[model samples]
Target: MKKTLLILIFLSCIVMANNLPELGDYSSSKISENEEIFIGRQILFQVNQSDSIIRDIEISDYLDLLGKRLINASTDPAKKIEFFIVNDSSINAFAMLGGVIGVHSGLFLASNTESELASVISHEIAHINQKHISRFLAQQERASYQSTFLMAVALLLARSNPQLASTTMAGASAGSVQGALDFTRENEKEADRVGIQTLNNAGFDVRGARDFFTTLKKANQFSGGAAPAFLQTHPITSNRISDIEDRLKDYPYKQRLGNQTFHYVKGKLKALLGDKSNTKNILEENIKNKIYINEAGERFALAYIYLMDNEFTKSQEQIQWLFDNEQSNPMLSQLYINYLIKTNKVTEAKKLYIQNLNFFPI
Candidate 1:
């Protein structure tokens, strides 16, 4: 069939990549490391200039540390990683050139544990580690003549390589491109395959990947057949779930302790975004009934919600709970400062802020 041939032609160059020993290399690419870095810089510049990027210091710092931890366990331990959280509520995350990974805030809220979140980061790292950059760029030039194939390639790479995607979409038919979108499921699968191993190496529970996929699948059912933004970008098929389950079988079953910071970050998003009343009730009930990820994080969320509601006394009570055990949390420190300033404690807030400069200097 015409469709089948087009898929084969477009993927011919990348097909043999499956049997390779290395996860592709910079030496074989026409785009040099410097060129890739420059491209990444431009893309990040565009992203930063956009209003959608979260400029929160606490969230950004946590993401940077979490991503770097996984990168240290990667095949290229010394590889530099830049991670950012977008302000969008959509469930999406992407990796691009120059070791850049951007995660949407909704994805952070959707993640249940540190390992689930790390699985997503690990998958993106694999995309860069596997050098989909060079292969995608090369495919763009080679497959340009066929409009449908080119469109499929661009759409497949849209989340990972948007600049190329924009250019490719301009000349192709949107109506026709859907047939060829499956061009890169192999690439996605490979990312998953490579990601879990790195995830395990990084000492995370690989089951987080499997559970996250199940979450996506369940979210899809109530989506009116439209799918989440994440599902659109990272298409999860039944086969992919089976593949993950099989890969998971290779690892011994053991629980990985969730990080307190991870729980705090998740709780932070819950309090700040979505339904405030619903989030407040959830946080309060979870804390009172002892049904929370980390009780400290739950109290932190309740404190944040109380602060936003101008319930300073109640907020301080929650902060005191966290203070009893964790007096050095960055997110809590910021929240406490905000609460202090709101209650006419500027002198004290400024003093505390100055004191934290040495430790929480982000």
Candidate 2:
């Protein structure tokens, strides 16, 4: 029965891929937009069922806000885009079918500024907008549903489990489908070109693209080993960074401040996902040494840790300090709300929720 089901799925995908439009007279072409969306949705359904996704509302909202800003600045503003945060700690982001983009939390931990994160996102968005994946598929005249299915599975496992991804790739070798999965150098260069333009249009610092790629190149050089998964997939070279730098010369120099939310989300991820004892120790050490430039962020992170540890009074104290300092951040407000609810102060939580709604109505 299972074998029969798999055969049916394969037949359906073959039909779908065949129905896709041809690449025109050009050597390269793309699947239809509708087909791309369909494939994306199928992959996304699998992704949703996996343990790799981060389902936090706050993190989701922040990523959506940042992603939408970049998407709005892209050449096609009307295109629907979906953003997801993968729980993996690997420094990677990937664009999938149907304008779906997945960002690993490690990407956030690796990025020094919001612009750095945005730069990567913009690049992925460029890939989707340029239909690079579809074009690659079009180039594979004998593209099969089996190959496509394995490609999606490989990508889903890439950041979360490289070993599994490698195993899947080896299995896919039965069909010689690996070549269908790689983006061409031309596609990479085009994405870089259009991505920086999108960053600039989005009012982010374009230097971010250069700086982020440069950092990755340097890290890859010093690792004394195989390239990281991100570099393995994205394949950064010295020329890529140089090209971005050259493009930077055309844009007016502008210094954009990093978003406060970026720091907050980073802290939250650390407290929530990092080693518990280690996270507590690090927060304590930072507090003791006064190490953070943004002390409120430190306190906010500590409060989250405290909440996780069930040190209710300590959590309240930290939250109160943030409120006292007039931090007024939505994240902090949510923390306060959570605290109130936890302490059985439902009335207070309700009142606060009403006040927050009044201040920032949807």
Query: Which has the greatest TM-score?
Result: 2
After superposition, the stretches of candidate 2 with alpha carbons farther than 4 Å from their true spots are 1-30, 143-163, 173-177, 180-182, 214-226
Model 1: per-residue lDDT, tens digit, 1-362?
Answer: 02232234224413322232342343334556765575555445545555556777777888988888889888778887677776656566887666678787878877878888889899989988888655665444332223322332334345533333344444444334333233278878998989899899989999999988777767668666656666666667889889899999999999766678887887787787778989898888887788965788788888999999998889999898888887477677888899989999999999999988878775
Worst 10 residues of 1 by lDDT: 143-152
Instruction: Please estimate how well model 2 matches the true structure, expressed as its whole-model Cα lDDT.
Output: 0.74
The CA lDDT at 275 in model 2 is: 91
TM-score list, all predictions: 0.77, 0.85
- Give model 2 RMSD, 1 decimal: 5.2
lDDT string, candidate 2, 193-282, tens digits: 999999999999998887787667666676676565577677666787677778889998886776778888887887888697788888
